[model samples]
Target chain A: MALLIAVAADDSLREQNVGQSLQERVPGAATVDIHGLYRAHWRYLVRLAVLLVDDTPSAEDVVQDAFIALHRRSGSLRDPDAALAYLRASVVNLSRSVLRRRQVARKHLKVAEPQTVAPADDSVLVRDEHRATLVAVRALPRHQREVLVLRYWSGLSEREIAQTLGISNGAVKSAASRGIATLHRVLGGAPDA
Target chain B: MRDGMGPDDIERQLRDSFDARARAGVPDGAMPPPPRFATAGAAPRRHGRWLAPLAAAAVVLAVVGTVLGLQSGSGHHGQQPVAGPSGRQTSPPVLQTSATAAPVDIRMVPVDGATYGVGMPVVAYFSQRFSSAKPLVAATSVTVSGKPVHAAWYFEKSAKPGYPVEGHLRMRDYWPAHVDVHVTVAANAITPATTVNFHTGARTIAVVEDAKHQMVVTSDDKSLGVFPVSLGTDSTPTGRGTKVIMAKQPSICLSGPGFHGCGIKYAQQLTFSGEYLIAAPWNAALGLRDTSNGCTNLTSADAEYLYRHLRVGDVVKYPDTTGPMMQVAGGLGDWNVPWAVWLKGGLIPTG
Candidate 1:
């Protein structure tokens, strides 16, 4: 089930009563406080950003920037239920911008270096094949890569991915299918008879 | 590693892969400190609004100062000073032209900071068509990792009659992966000064042999793997030379003259014409004797392995061929054309 976190401006009566049913269902999941929201979602959001941007420092920066933006705009969002969605969207958008900026920096900056893939002990974490999969996924087109990562990594359903990407449900489905097909081909998997 | 698995199995493997990578990367730790946010109902901070205008005034003063300095420095010339439209005595027209030859407005194709496939050609668009390209070519240089490479500028005409012309620079071969390209367009007789930088990601090259019926794959010059393959028949020979992997498909049905619903698996395109591919025959043994409509056929396993590893920028070279090599415009066929021939492809007219 998706988590809904309300970010209200203050602990006023109007804010309290805004989503009584959702509040009871999730039990204080809605947070009017930015710090509280950050404390709650920072880790997961950072991981998500890491998957998208492929680096921890940039990922953390992206997540932190997302929170700062959210905090600044918390007063404007009437529906507190949209807070988590806003954060997710912001993270994705910021990640794209980071990649774009990185691309430009790479072109002009002499200090630019290719991102080194951290070598992990195979016995402790990923198999060679799994790591290969990750590399292949990184090389996919942006839309296809985003859809695949959201669907498989985050376990978000097609509908959720569609909402997160602001694309249609059909687009999500096609992207997922295409991404999977590409992955299968890359991974040396045989087609179904 | 089982056969007949469907998309669901692939999805499960992908999920497992992503989870494993995440587990290795994200550590279990306390949440990092968040940026300071405005307290409950505090107004957001606003900086000075007049800073922009102040900066503009400073720039104007600097430009005027430089122009006046130039005029004074040229005052000793015996020629009479020219009168300006505003009735002020200005520097000679020649000196003014030298000072105000608007720095060539240069826009590099790929812009600054674009990641292109290995087949990308560095193109520079000039605001005006250059009368001579020798100065521009002499001043410009393309380097990889601070080391220079053989690159030449070809003048490409504007698509529309009156549109500005462009100079396209290309190396002799496809770019190696993960290398930074530094482009310096120095201020020269034909164009103004500009610098462009770009990067190529992960170099994957596949060499195919029709006579030997083998395909070798390499990443960053290290051999990843090799596989036996079937090449096109005598009637339909695969074109030779270099091609970039354009696209991939898991399975596609081939249909045309003299062909039925013949299926190919793990198909990666090599030509922009969509005519040739490196794929495996559907439901057939991979190493079977050559029989294709000008495509290199691989085993399903090999095809999938390549599909997983090869990206859009990766190069595929056909060293042995029964037919002529493809043209430069045929799918990233930049490597097929020789450096001298490629140099002539640009807009500069030969004397």
Candidate 2:
């Protein structure tokens, strides 16, 4: 059953990539080997999506959609080597879409059942310490979360994060600082080193 | 003593939490199914037979001119391209490419939208080994209840091959009950920028008695209930000290040396080692008889009530038992360990 799910996900990603490759045009630009690129980067991209969405199924969908979007515009890129950058940007944008949709659904659910607690199936089994840390991370503001995730989780440089999010490098730095400071305060202060 | 955690510590904790969660959520395997889209780019090619030869001649002239220019050293723009085994010119150095590959995979512990016990901490993990921790520490941030937290980051060294180094974050104290926590790591600082949100649930604690054969429950220090229970036999004593509720089930089948296909209802597992549970036994009278192996038997009504109210990470203290203290990592029983011992078990080295 797990294997089947994985295969289905892989196929979905490839189909999106193929669909995208056919849509966008870059006149006289070199055509990238979309298959090779997909093979190499699909897992990594999905992991990125998982961090953003916090679920495997949604993360897979997010990454697949990003590849398809990249494929559509792959031909128009001024530099063919910039394909990875484009994919990363697409993934981030699509993940936002997923989160926005989830927020809407949650709002509706809240309206329908104001007093009900969240279902238990929504959480994964992990250590209490880890769970607390994640809670703190999730509580950060959207921009700050993006910057922190990109900086620490993705290991992207400040400039690269700025480019991906279409923000200034200085903004990235400040957002990150504020975000970390917020985390420290929210987590009840860091332990003595 | 103040926890003067610098950027490096925060970076490490973030990396550890993210990596651990990502590892759990995403399976390592082949990609998923392909997407469906219209074949929009399949247009007929224009016939350009005459231009083919001209294009080849232009390419040949350009290659000759480039070689001559390189020999003269005047037209060499940057690092000279070397000839490969196939006799083709290698491409020039890519200036725009980053020095270190971005961390494409990440895992955050507790996951997004998860409700956790107040003792939980925020952790993040990345797939890339960090050479410089400055940018990561500067760019990543965490907050709880609209307020920032002073979180320490610890670099977690990986034990398995192919697994990337991890980062872990923790607060000096446990989380406040019923508060939301937010984490933000800037885009490109890790992979792509992202945010995580999770909320802490109510606070709960359990007091168990092996000598009196009873238990008491409390929420936020207010007494909730007191019920009778049956503890372990003399030979197979129940584990003493504090243990965290690791999981719960509506019903569980009891099997092992002292039992005969007996079923337990409303089972709440107290130990991480899976040896002990606080549950209602098949026979209600067992609640007053100390005949079980290692489990604590309770009445059906009380078991169901406690099971419904208890949350993972709630403390279950065996205050009156002579058994050994729960081991750290033996389950979620970190509370059983001494303060100094607990600090030593941290992923980060402390002063």
Candidate 3:
């Protein structure tokens, strides 16, 4: 009973202090336990999500949903370190699910909505070669695209990509290699030897 | 010379042009997440001690649950499930195996084709059509020259939750050398078990279909065709960004990226300068249509044909798709830059 009572007091104080500190920093932060997590990872998460979803607003939503999930599963994560991986995995899974659903939905809308396949307005004035290069990177597989974005755009290490994507490092390497080769093929270039 | 025009002069212009393109597509109100998480630094230290125990627990749980399920359904069966520590009720177990009293049908596939790369995924679909229910396959042992192989088995297209053995396979190693890799599955002795023999040569790889009609492509030689591809599940599917085909080879090769839970070698590869690879496993039918992370997709047959015809200097392009489209002769000629430090130009956006 004494140990139980002691444990209860400790839990309450820890919860209270964490809650109070977070609330002081951001209004309504009390509603979200992952405020710290969000503060730490929101930028990178948004970047990764945007690379997948393209739209900024949707990327933000994806990150926010991931944070919410983290908050709900805070108790299940006995170790704080797993929190980031768990969050990244959640975001990727959710994004993939959304994409699959969108593909199915696109079928219904394809007839009614004229398929307008135009390069972004910005690409118009860009030099033909530059446009070609950007287009080439865009052509890689979804997984490879994310890896390249995370590696180059985000500048994260391979370990980070594997963790974020919930795949083996081997898988990450495989995706990266295949993606780059595909880019070289499409862009008609050769790798630096 | 004042403008620094050289062999890569066109590339400099292209880089600037692409930089502007990135700026133009920059959507409003989209903020970049921080580069990494705070928890990352301390994760390894904390979990290092618990990994073994966690793995054992997982294996035990998997074995017990699967064995029980099999006994109730069929009296004579050999069941093997990768178990962990959560007793009988925990999360899903990764690998499961079972031998049927009656002959179980087994099929084999080869990782070959024009778009073959080191990490390309080659799937084998096996089935024994019965009058009563959906066809079932019994794959007892699968290997490349006697080396045990772990594969995800499913009766459906999508990798669903429970099919005993269904998930990604890490076979970067153990591939047969220039010969047929045999796969055998024991049945209850009803239907003839199947065998899959794969051969990857320096120039082309062959995908041998089983009695049933299933296609698997693999190749060590870089002589494959261009396949339309799309990014997998990442934020920037492969074909969305700037890319170029940087290399060509006639064989498969895998490299390690030095991360945890990943020690397997890779597959046939095509490197996109400053981007990722397009492995074989994910080559076909995964929400991609002429778009990929940064690679191209080609049908095995098309790839084989292209492999024979296309040269190293051939160009590719992506008009309105995620990656680029092949413009072997001219479309991308204006952008090829060999003597540039573009990777370090800081023009490439930070993810």
The per-model DockQ list reads 0.09, 0.07, 0.05
lDDT scores in order = 0.55, 0.53, 0.35
Considering TM-score, which of the candidate structures 1 and 2 is the better prediction for this target? 2
lDDT of 3 at B278: 28
Tell me, what's the RMSD of every candidate?
Answer: 21.5, 26.6, 25.0
Q: What is the per-residue lDDT of model 3 for residues B259-315, given as tens digits with 9 covering 90 to 100?
A: 111221221122212122223343555334433333333444444455554322122
Candidate 2 residue-wise lDDT, A42-148, digit = tens:
66677777677676556666766766677777668655457877888878887788778677767788775532322222236333444566678878887888888
How do the predictions measure up, each by TM-score? 0.39, 0.41, 0.30
Query: For residue B315, what is the lDDT in candidate 3?
Result: 28
B1-351 per-residue lDDT for model 1 (tens digits): 356446666676677666655534443211232133421233222111100111100000000112222334444232221221122121222322233344333322223454545765554433344445666667777799889987776554422101234445677666767888887877754445667676786777778866667778877778988788776666566788887664455565443223324356666666533444556545253454566656777766777787777654467888887755776544445566677776664445522
Question: lDDT ranking from best to worst?
Answer: 1, 2, 3
Model 3 chain B poorest ten-residue lDDT run: B54-63
Which number leads on lDDT?
A: 1
Give stretches of model 1 more than 4 Å off. A1-193, B1-120, B123-132, B147-149, B154-168, B172-177, B186-196, B201-203, B246-267, B275-278, B281-285, B340-347
Candidate 2 residue B269 C-alpha distance from true site, Å: 2.4
